[model samples]
Target chain A: MSEYTATVTVRLKAGVHDPEAETTRRALERLGFDLSALRAADQFELDLDAESAESARERATEMTERLLANPTIHDHDIEVEPR
Target chain B: MSEYTATVTVRLKAGVHDPEAETTRRALERLGFDLSALRAADQFELDLDAESAESARERATEMTERLLANPTIHDHDIEVEPR
Candidate 1:
């Protein structure tokens, strides 16, 4: 089996409240940094044994959809690469 | 001034314990997904008004270094693009 790494990124859906990111933005502003909107995303990297990159990505997608992200509130994307 | 977007990705330094990622990995395994190591990252997207992309990137780097990341435990990267 070939070893691969899958990167899964999750972000809150549009209009979802992102308090942590907002707080972070405010903190930056207080430090004299000027900026506008700030959105935060969660990225997950997974190593797997698979037949091919496609298979690894498939498994990672399943993992993302089922456990790594909340479908109702999060938008997720995945990328696979050889390890 | 022109508008730009800065993407700052924060990841735990190698050897840092990531319990949340571990928990998510275990949960994925229980659901029948096969995988090895899993790492999680925090990504921040910021909008800014700057004289140039270089300036926006500089500010974003400062934000990442000062407030968006904990240097003791995290390593971060920043990307700047026109908005």
Candidate 2:
């Protein structure tokens, strides 16, 4: 088994309302930062033992599908690297 | 001016206690997934008009420092690309 780190990034689907992002944008504007749009996401890094990068990605994707992301409202991307 | 997207990733500093990640790791284990360690982070994507990528990255870093991340407990990385 090889040590691998799977990075999963979960974002709200397009056209979905994100109150947190909206609030953050307002806060940034208040701080005199100029931005047209902002979006927020959650990222998870999982370190585990797997046979290959593909296997690590598969497990991470499964984790995202089952627990990390809401299928109806979220879109996630996963990347795996040897550690 | 050109359209750019600044991606900022914020993670807890090493040795910082993260209850959320701990909870998530346990949940994954309950679901029969094997993971030795897990860490969670927040990612922000900002879309803006800027003269150059460096300027966009600078603004994003400032945003991270002032609002997106807590300098006392979090470490952050910023990336910028043309949109």
Per-prediction TM-score? 0.95, 0.98
Best by DockQ: 2
lDDT of 2 at B64: 92
Residue lDDT tens for model 2, B3-54: 9999999999999999999999999999999998999999999999999999
Best by TM-score: 2
What TM-score applies to chain A of candidate 2?
0.97
Report the C-alpha lDDT of model 1 over B20-59, residue by residue, as the tens digit. 9888888888888777788989999999999999999999
Q: Local error of candidate 2 at B60, Å?
A: 0.9
Model 2: residues >4 Å from true position, as ranges? Answer: none
lDDT (0-100) at residue A68 of candidate 1?
80
Error of 1 at A38 (Å): 0.0
